[model samples]
Target: MLSQITPCLWFDGQADEAAKFYTSLFKDGKVTRTQYYGEAGKEIHGQEPGSVLTVEFELNGQNFVAMNGGPLFKFNEAISFQIECEDQEELNHYWQKLSDGGDPAKQQCGWLGDKYGVSWQVVPKVLGGMLSDPDTAKSQRAFTALMGMKKIDIAALKTAYEG
Candidate 1:
């Protein structure tokens, strides 16, 4: 069955490359199919005939399409995929992998922009609860700790929450 909603990512010319890279990172990911550009839209797109047009892939069970849509659009921080990490290890692993070739300047509050310019938030699942705790002091401490870091340190967050 097809997913009711799928995210389509736009790339300048790295649709296939990005798809492969992304799928490699997740255990539940795979490149299911790929499509190429034909001469039909030559005048508008100007891409070489038979070049990659789109790659349909699944990441962590969610279907996504990567399209070589030219430089007309770029990914921004306004929209980001948040990875709710189960623990510090999971959070560290993802943060390291995703931010390897990413711009260092974009790191803030567990949010990072990957090499493809796509924004992602690698946060521990406990973060939400800490931030929403009924005790204002605990929540505020957690918020302060969160605001001070780029990639999250689960220990520090917990300490702040327990304070």
Candidate 2:
């Protein structure tokens, strides 16, 4: 069974491509189904009858749908997908893959905008613990260090926390 809520990504006639790219990023990712526009809505949708309309995919076990909804809307940083990695290697891998051809100006504090304008936060699992340490000073230090980084560095955060 799937969850009650699923994220729907809007794209300008790139649903299929986006789905393939996203599925390729995670181990458990796959495209479950693809739907196409029909002649009945030709006037309303303005898309070819056989053209792809939506693609349902899973990324790291999370259900998502990419829709070829035309160019009426665009993606913004208001929403983002956060990938919590187990270690530095895992974090770096995801960060590099997702940020390829992305906007360099938007890369800050582990947040980046992918080529498709989708924002992603590639962070390590340890970040949560460091930022939430019981000791206020340690947590503050970690937070300060985090704000200064583009990609998260687990080692730096640990050093800040221990300080």
Candidate 3:
């Protein structure tokens, strides 16, 4: 059975590379299939015939597709995948891995842009609870603390929330 929805990532010419990177980073990740460009759409796609065109991959058992769609489009903060970590250790691990070779300037409030131009948010699972507290002061403090850091600091957020 085919999945009803699969996020397709567009890459300039690094579909294979990007797929491999993503799969290697997540548990149960793997390249399920590969597709090559053909002469049929040479005029429309302007891609090298017989070259790598698409890669079907899975991350943590979730299906995803990568297409060599040229540089017509790029990933931005408008659409980002959020990783809700259960603990500070998990958050640190993900943040370190995802931020490797990423743009430091774009890193803020738990948001980071990877080397592939993909934006990802590394968040703590307890963050929502703290930010949505009944007390506005507690929530605002948590938000203020969060806005000042690139990688989320659960301990800092906890301090701010408890204050």
Give the candidate number with the greatest lDDT. Answer: 1
Estimate every model's Cα lDDT from 0 to 1. Answer: 0.95, 0.92, 0.90
Instruction: Tell me the TM-score of model 2.
Output: 0.96
**lDDT score of model 3?**
0.90
Indicate the residue-level lDDT of 5 in model 3.
Answer: 80
**Model 2 segments beyond 4 Å from truth?**
1-3
**Candidate 2, position 88, lDDT:** 96
Q: What's the best-to-worst order under TM-score?
A: 2, 1, 3
Cα-based RMSD of candidate 3: 1.9
Please write out the lDDT profile of model 3 over residues 43-93, one tens digit for every residue.
Answer: 999998899999999887678899999989988888888888899988888
* Tens digit per residue, CA lDDT, model 2, 1-163: 8547899999999999989998888989999999999998789889999999999999887899999999999999999999999999999989998899899888998999998999999998888888888999999999999999999998987898889
Measured by TM-score, how close is model 3 to the native structure? 0.92
Clashing pairs in model 1, backbone N/Cα/C closer than 3 A: none
